[model samples]
Target: MTAVHGDPILTSEEGPIRTTEFESIARAVDRETEGVQVELIGGRLGVKRVPDGDHGRILNWLLLLLMPLNPGLFLHVIGQGLAVGSYRKGRARPDGILAPPDAFAGAGEWASPDAVVMTVEVTSHDSDTNHRDRVEKPIAYARAGIPIYLLIDREAGKVVVHSQPDEDGYQDLHSYAFGRAVSLPEPVGVTFDTESLKDMGD
Candidate 1:
């Protein structure tokens, strides 16, 4: 497909963040018009991108592989996708985002961050890779009123959960480790079996 015009130019400390603003806009427009399955992230009208690297590819593959083990979960593997707004500006595709289907009102296409109940970002090789997810992403998610945020640390083998958004990011913070079950609120009755992820990045 041909590219659209007047799209925002998105850049990051790492370079062009994978997908371009026009491409993302095109996807959004296509979702709106064609009524196909599409998901978007809108904040500060900025671009969110992730590059194709060993870290990104590895984490993405791991998430995709583990997702099937839990058929009840409807997660979005937003690798090299977009999460706009906040201090750490640029393209940021989390390792994977655990967003359930029931979060939305109608049974149609997926909406942007506003429709998102939660987001997840697994740490990459470089500390810089998670700079946005660690700080700005949570801030942005809270600002957008998203209820939850998860940051999985591959290096530390720990998962951090943030909930209860307020004036400054999430008001509640909790941590979980492998073999432990994590309970998800809202859209109701959702739980994540994180033990499957224990084999990730090994």
Candidate 2:
């Protein structure tokens, strides 16, 4: 498959992929899904889905419920691409994406599809949570310069925040439990309610 942006064409090479190539592929992908996120750059191609088991569904619903609380918060459901191409390749559908007003203000393409304020991954049945959260994603978002990373582990009932990406990986790391509240990075300072998540007694 190809991701097309303007006249160029892009595809994932399963290795060190270029930004321009990824952008082209992003624009070329079929805009067919009602809620699917189409992204290019990082590594993989096609539709990359969030872990959508029972817990995944509940966390997704809770993310949708976050809409009313933070008006500045914009929720991109299960399979929506956030950034296009700049650092990595492939589209990762976070359970929900919380973007501030300024980030969502512009009409046309704002930043890259991967240019998101906060990216959340609600863990479901993944046997290797650390792999996705600590290893692969760090490379992807760090390269893209994503501001913050939020990972919710339903099995462990934990919410981990990896904020401020640096040359290596995330700088600030914080973990919270069920009844705790996590405050997002600046410009918004929105306190994400962990209590309202899927199995957390919302």
Instruction: Report the number of the highest-lDDT candidate.
Output: 2
Report the C-alpha lDDT of model 2 over 51-131, residue by residue, as the tens digit: 446655655665666667667667555344555223444445456666654554453432454347777776544344455
Which 10 consecutive residues of model 2 have the lowest summed lDDT?
2-11
TM-score, per-candidate, Cα-based: 0.55, 0.63
Q: On a 0 to 1 TM-score scale, where does candidate 2 land against the true structure?
A: 0.63
Q: Return model 1's CA RMSD, one decimal.
A: 8.7
Q: Estimate the overall C-alpha local distance difference test score of candidate 1.
A: 0.53
lDDT string for model 1 (1-202, tens) is 2222222233244334333543566466455543112222332233233333544654565456436744454566633244434432323344555555454335222235555556777665443435445776677677656687877766777778889986588988888886577765654235666676676633
Per-candidate clash tally: 4, 27
Error of 2 at 72 (Å): 2.1
Tell me the deviation in Å of residue 18 in model 1: 19
